[model samples]
Target chain A: MKILAVDDEPLVLRLLDATLNGLGYHNTSFATTAAQALHLLESSKSPYSCILLDIRMPGMDGIELCQQIRRMPAYKTTPIIMLTSLAEKEYIDESFASGATDYMNKPVDATELAARLRVARLIQNEYQRSAHLEELNRAQIEGFQPMAPFDFAEPVQIDDVSRVVNSRAMENYLRQLDRLGLFKIGVIGFQIRHAGSLHAANAPEEFYGILADVAESISENTREVNALIAYLGKGSFAAVVPRASQIDRRDLEAGIAATLYEFELADLVDSTSDIKVSVGTQINGSVFGNTPDKMIDLAVRSAQGMTESKPKALAARIWSLAG
Target chain B: MINSQETAASHLAAALAEIRARFINDLIPLINEMEYQRVAMTDPALAPEAFSSLQHASHKISGMAGSVGFPELGDHAARLDVTFTKLLRAPYDHAGVQAALDPLEAFLSLMEDILDEVL
Candidate 1:
């Protein structure tokens, strides 16, 4: 596969070349500066399969190069890996923001580098295939018959929630995140005070509808926070915010609670126990015994604790607002 | 005669060995530079540049040292990077900076022995 390696450090470039060659990735090109890299990218006959780069450079660092490359129609779908020593969150965040697909900390291990390249290659191929299909015909994408809308029953779309994900899906996502050994995840659990009371609301759809309004409020306010909100059912919903270390869970909780509060969430859920956000900081697989059930149980317990702890918060606040 | 695969494995092992030694050798200068920067940080006038340099150096090590067979060094460097970053945000927190320096100082001392074995 054709790949480009960009770095200003001669030693680092040599190491990258040797490592990639050692892994049998021999058709690799080298450039010392972002300008040179851009020249090579523009001049190359075959579109590169992958690009590996360093963040810090003599002129126009890798991030800018990544952004410039992404802007190009030809390289839009190609995978870019930032192999750099600047492994701080700010640099990583900036790289991803500039449209980096994968980030590998350096000095990189040969095996790890090879594995990342393989993964990136697979992703790039998939992206290119999809892009090509769109080129063939816009109808290629829209031609499929849309799934029939639920006649009070269709499989839930776990992604964009007109309502938070259902109980089982939430648990599954939590389990998947934990199993991935991505420990810096935060979960903010919201316990609906009287889910049982919702039975009176015509059908389960109405209860879910109220939950959707609450979730929408959450999504709108915490848009910058960039978290996943899910419904764990049984009066519990959770927002799992990745990169928990960089984000202050308390501030996020307060922001969400404020939105829910100002919106007078009591009108939706009916019973007023101001959604006391139970923030879970440690999301390692080891935490909550590595099962979604335990995590859900803990969320339920937290919601129950909120009821006991702050019996009068929702009512008092709502009354004050009315008065 | 060894197979080509075995030869490649040893070659990789040898390359890694060189990197490990270079990594330890590199830490000495980086840690020395940071010591100088830390002293500069005591002077209110020089603190900002000193802290910035220290953070950059620590950030470099934190990003690569772990992969180069010095995971503890990476962890220590990461803490220093974080401490320097926090101090950068609040330069007047001399007491906080001093508290942060203790762990970094401990790690540098620990590294001297690791360097001996590695070198």
Candidate 2:
């Protein structure tokens, strides 16, 4: 795969070059500055399949560079991995907010870099396959059964919403926080009350549009607390917020309902006029024994009202027995 | 065929060793430049720019040193970078600058020792 790596330090670039070459990635280009990187990206004959960016640079740091690349139409869904040494929360938050697909801390381990690149390659291949399927569908080929590119339960990326990230990126953010021992986050799940009915009633595209609308409403409602929202498919969404932020469940539900109501009135939603979302109780990550997947699962169950009493009662019983 | 694979692996190892050696050689002058900035940081008039330059160098070293087989140097550089960043946020003072100098000097000495051994 064609790759581009941008860093101001030539030694780091050389090291990366050697490492990447050792990993059998030879069609790689290097740039010492963001401007130069942009030039290389634009002037190249074919778009680079994967991009590696450094967070700190003299002009236009990696976060800003990632944002700029995302604005380009060709790279909207391309894999952009941030390779940085800065482990500050602010940088990590900004990197994902700017549309980075993955992040890796530097001192470039060959094994880890290879793994990240493998994931990037997989993402790129999937994009290509979807694009091909989309083209075939658009062409209206004879006797063709149009297939839905994504499953109803797959976490589809909701684009064009501020502070909204893909599910994978959200998980990675949480994992990074966990690694840093700074995982003081609250996970909340939101589920559309009638998502299944809506999905069955409308066309796939229409259902997707409704999902995007719900995602936008969730994003707008949680904008005040700086929540990172992701649509974890089947009409469910998850939001990660700083645990210290006070989130009243009633207010959030009301706010989202009001926004969806406004969208229905404006004809922005076709069949989602009766749709309501259930807001889950915030699940705070404990100082110990809380993984990202477990927190997310608990939040989703809470939204679904599956674990309202059983788990809590069971935990209480266990604690009493231990006592 | 196995011989070819072994040859390729050996070639990669040699290339990586060369790059690591070159990185150490290049780091010496950069560390010297950081020392110059560290000294310049004591001057009130030059303190802001000096601090900025020093932090930039330390950040680079912290990011790159470990990849080139100097993990301890990278840790020291990271500590120095954090110290400079914290000092930059507060008001500029000689006491803060003086306190930062010990780590900077220690980092410089560490780099020197590593270079002496590596070279």
Candidate 3:
């Protein structure tokens, strides 16, 4: 695969070239500045398969270079990886905004770089294949008989409107959803327990306050949530947390449930009544693979399982489903 | 089928209207209050009135701006508020007031640009 390695440092350039070549990768090109990199990219006879760029450099940085590459028609679809010494949150965000496909820290390990490159190639190939299939699909549709309108019978499940309208805490919940959705780990479901009792209670304001606090606290700790943490009517709340590849599904489920229990949310509310929390988790093998929507559905099922179990100080149930 | 151009234009218009309404109703009032305090502070005889008004005006503007996600504006207003508060709390400094006002004006322009984007 043809790779363009751009860095201002000579040592970094030499190391990357040697490392990639040692790993049996051929056709590597080098550029010291953003201008040189762009010049070579625009003029190079051979199309580069992937580009690795350093973030900090003289006369236009990697982010600007990546933006420039994206603007060019030839390299619009090319995968670009930002190599940087600092993996700060702002840099990571800027890298993504500038259209970087992947990011790596400077002084990158050869093995990890090779693995990332392989993944990048795979992702690019998959995207190209999908684009080709889409074109074929359109062609076939044009040639064949007109199909019926897509089925509208399936009712669209609107997640609890409160989550969206509750802007005060929505950012935290939304961030969790984004993280989980990206990972495509599992399904998530939410139930709002004690709603009726809380509303009917003498101190309704205090009860709601407790509920909001608990939701905010849970949202803070949990990431990789596939589904909305909906306020299931009657004061129950739930969400599905995606488990990373290295994570043990059973342990992850238990750990999250335990964390929720440990959160001193009840203290936030001036409540005289005892606080009870119940959670249900399922190992969604099928939904765990990928696809954000499917993963969310699986998480919802797991959350559904929690409501069925008897309520305790902190009740949690586990359900296993085939992937 | 709805045309994407039409959809985008409609959404943009709706966003713009909402932004205009917010700026007029919410943001402008706060700015006027700040201006009032600025005027009041010009006379040393009304120093107490000016100090209280400035404190109220700047704090409210700063807080509101921050809540609505125009934090840079909020920060500028906040810095100005701090300078005003310092002037009142300890000793008065005209140079600090001037320094703070310059940035506040810059931030006001920034707020206008941000409103355009949101709209």
Best by DockQ: 2
DockQ, each predicted model:
0.28, 0.63, 0.01
TM-score of every candidate? 0.58, 0.87, 0.36
List runs of model 3 lying over 4 Å from the truth.
A131-323, B1-119
User: lDDT per prediction?
Assistant: 0.63, 0.81, 0.53
lDDT of 2 by residue, A1-323 (tens): 99999999888898888789878898999999999999998999898999999988987999999999987766777798899888887888889888988888888899999999998998888768775434433433343444354566767667678988888778877887787787678999988866778778876667777888888999988988888888887888899988988898756766676677668722222332566677899999888777999888888878887322232343343344336
**Distance (Å) between predicted and true CA of A182, model 2?**
2.5
Best by lDDT: 2
Q: Relative to the unseen true structure, what is the C-alpha lDDT of residue B15 in candidate 3, on a scale of 0 to 100? A: 47
What clash count goes with each model? Answer: 0, 0, 22
Which pairs of residues clash in candidate 2, taking residues 3 or more apart in a chain or in different chains?
none
For residues A230-291, could you state the per-residue lDDT of candidate 1 as single tens digits?
65545456665554445444444445455666666543244354433433332323454546
Q: Please, what are the lDDT tens digits per residue for candidate 3 over residues B20-109?
A: 355435555565665666656656667557766666555545534543345666666666666666667754556755555665556556
Off by over 4 Å in 2: A131-150, A265-272, A306-323, B93-95
Worst 10 residues of 3 chain A by lDDT: A150-159
Fnat per candidate, as a fraction, reads 0.31, 0.55, 0.00
TM-score of chain B of 1: 0.83
Docking class of 1: acceptable
